[model samples]
Target: MGEVTTSLQRPVTNTGRSKLVRHVDSFEIQPPAPPSHNGVPRSAWARARRRVSRWHRPYITLLLLLDFAAAAVASLIAIETFDQSRAGFYNAEQDPTWFHTVAFGLLPLGWLVSLWANRAYDRRYLGLGPDEYKRVIRAGVAVAATVSFLAFATKTDLSRYTVGTALLAALLLILLNRMLCRFVLHVVRRNISQAGHRMVLIGTLPECLEVYTAVTRNPAAGLMPVAIHVTDGYAAAKGIETPVPVYAGRDVLALVREVGGDTIAVCGSASSEPGELRRLAWQLEGSGVDLVVAPQLTDIAGPRVHIRPIEGLPLLHVEEPTLSGPALLAKNLMDRVAAGFGLLLLAPVFLFIAIAIRISDPGPVFFRQPRVGHEGRTFRVWKFRTMYVNAEDRLASLVDRNETDGMLFKMKEDPRVFPVGRFLRASSLDELPQLINVLKGEMSLVGPRPLPADDGDFLGDVRRRLLVRPGMTGLWQVSGRSDLSWDEAVRLDLYYVDNWSLAYDLSILWRTVGVVLARKGAY
Candidate 1:
């Protein structure tokens, strides 16, 4: 819910029924009839659901065991390092070793309870996103608070060193362990086609297709669309082909059961025939299937959106982006500081690259191009030259071979790029010189990527990207770089601009490391 200001005005729909337009609008379009079920046996869907649950439970169990082991190892290390022999509990009322042994046994159990209470073990948060890590941190803090409170209340001589070390070590171990587990899970999900939730999509054909496209793009999300259930009004809509099995009927519950769908994604404009959603919810009460509503909103991050309940109705409140003020100043300061440090640290590497380039090609080591920055201002962006001296001259001939879509031109195997240039481009070593651009305040470390002046003039919603300084590495670079279409890249950039935050910047930076190392979508 980053401030969504669309140039297109909202079309006037029939609002006479009620404050909320819940019913489906009648359209002349007719959808295709339900296809034959011969291609996909009903049991296949059930097996997929069962397989996902089977894998997920063991994964959760493994996490629980790993959590226990991390806590136990931390406690053991603490006990050995800070022996309770010198620090008696409650004026030496009990033997120090016995008391310490008992504490050690209870510490890990207590930690597990804390983790369970904090929802760190919640399946929804596992294998994706930062919520899992955040929950673990919260649990660690809770454990430390409880320890301190108990010690103070009992007036016991509990060693602070032992408690602090155990908590810190346990938290670090748990996070690292989770990272490993998640990595393995992602690998399995990517390699194993059936390793995910079997979802039945319910909505208009267009909306269902949109959701299907978005979910399938990210295999790590683990939402496999097994089928699509078109709403009543759009059941007869035509002229569109669906990738998955498409079905239409009033008995959604029966459809879900028949297909053994573990999840139902109610996409935009789902049938709302007078508490249609409520009735569906009631039907799914005891069923293991989960109901997820995909709102029409797009490119809105959770931070900018707030759920405000007004008389039981939930309204999404979007906050304006932080383009200026203290946060902006901090971002600028970070760019300069990090750029300066990077330049210093990589001085030798830079020299080696410069020398190599100079020997291999008879041109300048650095390439400077005029690019649009904040507020449509143009600046010379510096980058290690990765193309031959006559590269620009060859652009016209290669126009037809452009592999990318949009005003920008890109060729996966451009003849203009010399032998070493390909390596530089693939490794993104060519972008290292942009540290100079960053240090000069012409660019940021994380923001929308600057467009070359010749690309085209920006207008309307696209211009919103220029509200902030261009970045050396933005969402586009980390997402797919040359692999993403122009529209998708622009959408990501606009999303970044509208949802700028320190945490988001840091997250993008972290992901950039992996992207660069993997050389994904780089040419």
Candidate 2:
């Protein structure tokens, strides 16, 4: 009875015991079933966390809230302005209740929708270039058109004056709000640690270096280079040394992940094949990574470039630069009218400057220099004399001390300038006499700076600047004037020549005011 009981408790043979041992071994070797919390995998939770962190939620939320508030305030201001204007002008059937509902509620909603449709608040556009402002203006115009159409369709006796005034006021207010937001964004972007997208550059050493340099210089662009994947050769071969680590490999996605980069910027087509790029783009989708392909073409604005897709190839259609047309005619008319009005308004100030210059030195109150103008024609450019009579003779002596780029002669503290001349140069009052040039049609309100006839090195593509009349204040003046390098000045001039428009001229003129007030790059 005891033996029978032991046999029942123990294994029948070594086979049973070995089978049990094998089962235990299997349980230990089988990879501990991926850590689970509440039946969900740890890997899934990690992915969700990464995705949530990648979103610029704070910035986007704040910007959206600000825009909504701006729209509300704009609507209120527009309503008030319309009421005041209507009361002062045309007598219209006043329906306060209806007007208030439409103006404050309907109008703001429509305007907001229009702004969204036009991509006014796009992350790519905000805080960079004039795209955001352009979108705002486009939306405003669209809203105005829609309002006009609705007024006509409904046959509502809406006062044209009231509608027009409200639209104008709303447009201006929106612009002001956007400008303020842009200023704030600029401040935020100045700090590298606090702002910008972390980018992993993928390109040949030279191409990547060029892009890296531009990104570093323009912090407001919000692209910060964190790592570089050199495709063609070693960075040393290209004489490029970046603060960021240099990577070498074909696995761009892995490299981006290793560097914690949110963006992958491909500099030029040579960086990767079309098939590879397509694959990379596919892999990056849903990965919270932005891919930016930098085309070989540089310094070209968006308006001139149009993408035409044909046979699976995206062909870029670059419109030829127009030097003349209706735009030029309008610009000419504006320049004449503005110059005439300015001369009249500034007559007293101009007289004071002339007298001051005459009293300071016994020389001509005005300086007329022969400059190359439109179509390479010679024109006498006018300026309030801010130098001694012997300034021309002294130029040779000061050449060695020139503080500006070699192409342009500039002296911050030239002996040839008298005390009044120095003040005039510093204040840019010396340029006031150019208003007469604008009136005479020898100069424009905005264009490339007129090079002196003696400075004949501006030939070839540089001479494209002569396609339009030289300006009293140009991209060169507002950008940096004497402080800009020769290449930078020429690039700006070329860009202006290639993309001339009334809106662009007006923008430059507006910026010119602020630049002059700041006295940046003056003298």
Candidate 3:
């Protein structure tokens, strides 16, 4: 990712300044005539936008209805299960329908209100990231707090069982509903080309191409790059081929209109002018097109970034990574507790696996190898042996057959691995013994995957990964594992190191279950 140092006011250099100025001036002098529609509607793009708009509203409405239904059903089930007859402001004996009415109506309404207040239903959070889940959880807490406060204020004998059960069930149902909805949306976006925002990407050649690749790769994000408008005329003139149709940056609004693009994504260093983005926004004001600015910053999560407005300029402030203090302490505590619990609970499975390995081949059940750990420390990491005893000796002969690059070595079908080993590797069961490594505090349950002690002497930015304990599983494991390029794997590892949070760790752990089960990207 490119680092942004200069302000948005990065001056137009003299190299091609005059030629480009003349080129842009010519556009102002003689605007390209709009393509004659020959009586056809010019609102085709607008119609498509309206169609997408319609889709968004209906989907959100459906989510709302589902939430209401979930809350209502949860309330009903809780009250019925707990037999809260003598609860709430009015007792069931005094007014039989009073508690029922409140449970069925007020509880659901309050839940919806809490969700709305927390922006759980915001479009930005609808189908992606853990923010949606976080918001939902926050809404649940808000509802719980409200209930507790109301009960205390009114001196009502609210049934703890009923309230607790209702909130728990409602949150679960809502989260499940969101997951299903996201799955459906992903499928639709992947299969249907017209399902997402048709975007016109604006940037220099390299930046535009980078953003284009990212957008196209993640179909779940709903950003379809329809065209590219290069801000660097020299790069465009070099006849560099691009994935999307290229255009001059001077006529950006015209290009979007021609390409039916409903979104304009401005990638890194799109302009030399300080107010170019603001001007672009002004140009898009009445066009019903979204303007998105992609900063050079990458891999930094939202929680670490903040925008501070002074006068008319908005400055981006990034907080330093939380490498120490209460958060890391909490993470340490969580890792030890979870690792201890997992070891005890999975002892029988571990024993079974050891027996299988013994039967499959004559070698040690556990493979312990020296790995780089926190602060450049070396530790013996443990894993179930998934290769023959002579695997290391055969490595020299198979060096040319390595499928992956960089300090790592991988092969889809290594001759050294036994049949049972293949199964264990694919299912990631071989790594189960690393619970011991985690328990010993040599590794975390989530962080950068430790490299072999001889991978290479860590240097420069790569050395940052050693600041935290290596992990049994991490962002790289959940993302692509062996399928990822060496550089990409390193980048993911660095991202994990830089932006680690307990929530992020938990999310990775949750996704790791799915990734392992699906055997995606596993050797």
Candidate 3 Cα deviation (angstroms), residue 92:
3.6
lDDT of 2 by residue, 104-185 (tens): 6777788888988999866777777888888999999999899878767977556666677667777787788778877776
RMSD vs true structure, all candidates: 9.8, 12.8, 7.7
TM-score of each: 0.86, 0.80, 0.85
How many Å off is the CA of 59 in candidate 2? 3.5
Better of 2 and 3 by lDDT: 3
| lDDT of candidate model 2 versus the reference | 0.74
The order by descending TM-score is: 1, 3, 2
Clash number by candidate, in order: 5, 0, 0
Instruction: Name every residue pair that clashes in candidate 1.
Output: 30-236, 30-237, 30-238, 31-236, 31-237
> Lowest summed-lDDT stretch of 10 residues in model 1?
1-10
- Per-residue lDDT of candidate 3, residues 297-347 (tens digit): 888988899999999788889999999999999999999999899999999
Runs in model 3 lying further than 4 Å from the true structure: 1-54, 87-89, 93-101, 141-160, 191-194, 234-238
- Best prediction by lDDT: 3
User: What TM-score does model 3 achieve against the real structure?
Assistant: 0.85
